[model samples]
Target: MEVVATLAGMSSSRTEALTPSQVRSARAALRALGRAGMAECDVDGQWAIRADASAEHAQSSATAYRCVHDQVVEERCEYRAGGVSQWSVQQAAELKANRAREQAWWDGLEAPERAERRRARQEEFAGLSVVEQERVKIELAERRVRAGVDEAARHDAWVDGHTMDAWVRRSIERQYRYQRLPEPLQQAKAAAWQRHRERFGIARGTPLATSRREHAAALPSTAAGRDEEFLLVDSGGRTTRRDVETG
Candidate 1:
């Protein structure tokens, strides 16, 4: 007769609910070919009892690694717990072993070989574009910042040669922060930008004009007659008004 068990309370009083720890004990009993009243069990809270079943049938789904004192056992025995597959367990074990072996091999390498490897990696990095290099630097810096090894900065002397305030001002001048900047910062940045344009003629359809228009439009209640001062002057010293379209 085939009998089964599950996490759900057993239907018959003769069957007892087994804890995860009891799985191996039950499996050992089932594997003993001549053992009487033994039940074939799996780690997935499942078991079966058969009057005509043999030890081979009981051990077919078993792993070659054994679980010892609830610790993992390596080689020729199966670790059986929590329904974890033997193949997956073996793969993890092998990966860990391989990492150790690789570390040992690397440690045994000659100084020259290690130096050459470092030089090769440096060369590969040197081949990247300036923009790509800057991106890598920012990513590394951000990682360092997250690890508390460094403080986050918008720019560094070697990276962009601009301080955070300068970067924000530049972003505003480039129209990248027209609507994004705080109202006060936007007005201050716009005033500073207007001074720059007066000193150096504001070109039509440029970031300066676009940002000014956006700033004015965003605060129409306060921008009455304020936008009139933003006039584009040509090389001939004549003022020409041009509407710069926002993208």
Candidate 2:
């Protein structure tokens, strides 16, 4: 009743159905669900929480590595409730967000860009010691078996029967070795992406994509396998890259 009166005071015609105090209480309760990521909605006694807004919000925000704002808030609440340090909670969030962005960036690349990355990465892999290379191969093969990305019969045909028919097979086989293996292996395949950014040397919270075009990296020409510094003139004719770092 008090909530109704408070709502009435705010706007008698619009909020006749609710007490301001009750609305305040409900809103307070909703805030604890801060991590639920649902934006606050005005409850004007409309059809069932404003026509399925929660479901719509969930569908709209669904994306890689994002837990919706409400969920994020809820996680922070949990951390707080459990006596976890604020720094730890913040660090975990930062790491999770960074890794997601990196994966999204990698996933968004065109086939040619991905191929070029693979070629560049292959070069990086070759720089490792022979023992390290062998270990990575073994790790990758095991990961393939566990992931069911390829069946044992396929491996048997390739490994035991030597039935590989395409040159691309080796490349695909090599890439997944690291692609599938997160530094430390995970029991569940779904959660193993934690260390995915480590493979690319991306720092935590760095975006994989950006609206700023000038910050784009130049893909090195791999044919000659040589390094050269180039000059970049921006739209405003601002000299940006001269093989140097600027603040």
Candidate 3:
């Protein structure tokens, strides 16, 4: 069961929003509500958390939110356990609708428009300061590393006979997660994931193509067929087959 908690209106009417510490405290409290299985929170529910004034006030409000969230969960537990819960049904429907809408929007874009958008994004990035550029680069690299690790885990799971449904679910979960990031970070994550896919040769219908190629390449060459002692075996999956000079 996935729990969605919204820190509703953390900002305030004041010129300045809540302090960083207060925001963190409030987020932590919201996570606690999620951990305790508050499946869905009402945006205008009877309970409210007004935390823009001070950190102490934010903490108190967070505690109050948690108490109310817990009570709501407890009240709904029996209905949730017995059959299809309203939250699950509603969430699934929303997800399906959102995906359809997004796909339609993407499909409606022309090639020239897409290319122009990409060029504009490149220009925007090039216009950033050196420090900002470095930050973006570092974030992109980290995302690629994370994606590689996740791909390896997925490959292992597939080898161990996990269902294809699990793989699809994991991918959808990742998509939903990065889509929620701020625009720049979201683009970086998406590009990193795209590069990860290319590195692993994950085509539309063949996710394991590169793995199979690497496995075939890893075998000793037909010309070098012998009881050769293996000193170092480096399987450069992306490079397929390359002779390494070992001194």
Candidate 4:
């Protein structure tokens, strides 16, 4: 009978499953053939059982053959099952050669040439320092001012050349008048106007109401006005416009 077993438990269970009578008979037959049961012998010498055995002993011989066959099949299955192999020396040597070639390529670059490239990059950055940036900003502001003046001149030329409506002329005149002031001065004047409106509780886009008395009251007492000019008042009151101007 042929027996099939998995590679995992083949060796242990196969030995245990062999009948005691069969083991004893196999041992006797091996001894009769001038072979020790547990001794190591050449594969060819073991196969010589067929030529030497009698008809009656043939069954025992076949049983021994079956045992050896199963052992060999189990070993071969275990070897192929894992799908692993050892690497050869030639493969390792090729890897080392490739690494050496890469290292040699890097070493061949000129040191002085690399340093020169680095220095050029540093010099380019040095030209963009804070002071250099500030000078560039001032130059740009001057250029912008000049360009605005040129644009205004062109616009005025166009307005004078054509007969524009009254409203268009007034709008253009107002824009040009505002543009004539320096940018910083224009910003300061706008901030002052906003403060003045807020303090006097005036609505935006409404004209400020001012009589002669109100105008004189708002101005300093140094000039002649309707308001009474007091003198020698208390410490807090002395700080007023009347005392200061009189003093």
Candidate 5:
């Protein structure tokens, strides 16, 4: 549920195609749509905003398309051609197919199998040390964020009618949202996230792998050794601690 902007015909002479005010207004409108679960919008910024700029500022008068979903080709106003671009369309289709496969796999699991799966996961959670358990909690929290972003991305892909990389990057971006920070700090956090993703080889989001039963046998599967303390990160990128009674 986010608006993805694309300049149909862009030029380097201009830092932005639309006026600063227009960009702000359009962005606000798109966010409103997201909140309401609205699908598509054509702001006609190319006509309204482009009319004000001279040829020197605007590369061309090509229509600027802003979609609630991802766009296949991100035309920067460098040069816009008339014919339809095919790359983005193909990507979106692929993503949908992949998601369907994942859903099917989950739906095919039997009741006993699912119960065993849940048992296995709890065992894995219990096996970690106190510190590792805390880390896993953080990871799970981030995964929740990723799920939301995926929904937003799906909206974008459908509305824009184009292909795009999965919205995995949103998980990292959502972390600094609670408070405004200086540019340097923002850059520092982004760098830290990059290192973490690389270290863990988790640039893309996926379902967790099931641990071998033999390995899980060594771990306590019940709540006996579980710590009640949980670190939670909310949608606003705010962090808080909560302790649940294991009893």
Candidate 6:
């Protein structure tokens, strides 16, 4: 069962409303009436009464019961009545209808009117000098070009290189000795060396041989693959030799 209550000290007039204590008493009475299966009733200028009644009669009696109940409870509770604004169901319905009508009126406008408004905005923009328009266009073009270049660079970096396997082989060969490398690795190393020399503008003939020789001379005497019996003489006249092997 549902119960409705009227606050006490609340004015029956919309301008001033009932007090909290009055509302509490009203709520309690409504609750009791609901539990007892009785509807609250009121006669003008009399105390509120609870009675067993039909639903329709109960609903109709609520207004009168609320008015008398609020007055009596407010008097007994000595509570201050507060102001309230009231709106009828009809008034609320009218407000909603007015809003919907306004929205529909806006929606009913012709496409041409909307287009005209858009064209007016465009005309305002077009009224700017030609040089300003050109400047704006140029800025937009530059921004697009920059964005295109950045996208292209990102795409290129993401692409897998066609020569990645060959490059890996060359790298392995460089780490190990070329003579000890497998046939495929050896070819890769040679290709890599030629490519490097070409990139650095080095001649592929005698000059490259001389460079390799000079590189070999820089290695320590104890380093592998050098002739062990060979001697190196320093500027101070000190001589060093590779140790002889005996079997």
Residue 212 displacement (Å), model 6: 8.2
Q: What does candidate 4's lDDT look like per residue over 106-200, in tens digits?
A: 56769987678669966874467444544554464444333333333333444445322332333334444456668985676566546544543
**Alpha-carbon runs more than 4 Å astray in model 3:** 1-83, 118-208, 211-247
Top candidate when judged by TM-score against the true structure:
3
lDDT of each: 0.48, 0.46, 0.53, 0.47, 0.44, 0.49
Colliding pairs, model 6 = 7-23, 8-19, 8-22, 8-23, 9-18, 10-17, 10-18, 10-19, 11-17
TM for candidate 2 is 0.24
lDDT of 2 by residue, 1-247 (tens): 3332354354355435555665776556455333344334347732122223355446655753365666678767878788666666686677667657877999999999999999998898768654565557557655544433343344334443322222223323333354445554423332332343333233332221221112322333332211221223222333445423553
What is the C-alpha lDDT profile of model 1 across 1-247, one tens digit per residue?
1122232233243365565555554445445633533455468746565566555645652433233423444422443434655667686677667657867998999999999998998888768754565556556554544433323232222234544334333433344325546888667656654553343343333444355455535532223222332222223342444432221
The positional error of residue 219 in candidate 4, measured at the CA in angstroms, is 37
In model 5, the runs with Cα more than 4 Å from the true position are 1-89, 129-247
Q: Order of candidates by TM-score, top first?
A: 3, 2, 5, 1, 6, 4
TM-score of 3: 0.27
Best candidate (score: lDDT)? 3
Q: After superposing candidate 6, which stretches have Cα over 4 Å from the reference?
A: 1-176, 205-247
Q: Could you give candidate 3's per-residue lDDT for residues 34-135 as a string of tens digits?
A: 444432345764333333345565577799999989877865985767865666678667766765786688789998998898899889886885457656
Candidate 4 residue spans exceeding 4 A from truth: 1-170, 206-247
Q: List TM-score per model, in order.
A: 0.21, 0.24, 0.27, 0.16, 0.23, 0.17
Q: How accurate is candidate 3 locally (lDDT)?
A: 0.53
> In lDDT terms, how accurate is model 6?
0.49
